[model samples]
Target: MKIQNKRLFASILFVLISVLCVAQGPPYPGGGPPGPPGFPIDGGILMGVGVALFYGVKKILGNK
Candidate 1:
């Protein structure tokens, strides 16, 4: 096929695909689907950061 023919075919195919994509209907009345529950880190993240900072400080202040 010629280059113009190929481009026309591609444009038609793209339009059809976009129509399907945009036809997903309206959103759920109840504010869409629910996401995963929140993860409880408590003090684990802070503890890790604290330990890393302590190690870094110790290394920086150490004598050669």
Candidate 2:
């Protein structure tokens, strides 16, 4: 019971800290994503899809 209580306290503390940090984020400008002009809008999305596909193919082929 003591171990469970400690874990619960840690989880609550972590969530409170995360919320506080998010509330203190930098200011947004121009009512758009946080970046300068002409940012690669789909860069992160494309990279994520590419990585997922790569891993899927590797798993299908049993590379390990």
Candidate 3:
């Protein structure tokens, strides 16, 4: 019974918090400024990091 009550309280709190967060809005009254238009470079950076990590681990293991 205690655990059930705790879970119910947590659920209600979560819902209230989420609703309040969504209730707030940006201070701007009109449409925001236009953002940069171009392809994202994050993907390339992620791929490079992945390759580096893979090679580093492989080199550490001394597996050819």
Q: What TM-scores do the predictions have?
A: 0.42, 0.41, 0.50
| Model 1 segments more than 4 A misplaced | 26-64
Worst ten in a row by lDDT for model 2: 25-34
Candidate 3 lDDT over 2-64, as tens digits, reads: 999999999999999999997988656674655678867788899999999999999989965
lDDT of 2 at 24: 74
lDDT to native, each model:
0.89, 0.86, 0.88
User: Per-residue lDDT of 1-64 in model 2, one digit per residue for the tens?
Assistant: 6999999999999999999998874666654466577766688999999999999999989965
Which candidate tops lDDT? 1
Clashes in model 2: which pairs? none
Ranking by TM-score: 3, 1, 2
What clash pairs does model 3 have?
Answer: none
| TM-score, predicted candidate 3 vs. hidden true structure | 0.50
Candidate 1 lDDT, 1-64, residue by residue in tens: 9999999999999999999988887576775776658887779899999999999999989954
In order, how many clashes per candidate? Answer: 0, 0, 0
Error of 1 at 29 (Å): 6.6
* Regions of model 2 farther than 4 Å from truth: 29-32, 36-64
Model 3 scores a C-alpha lDDT of: 0.88
The better-scoring model by TM-score among 2 and 3 is 3
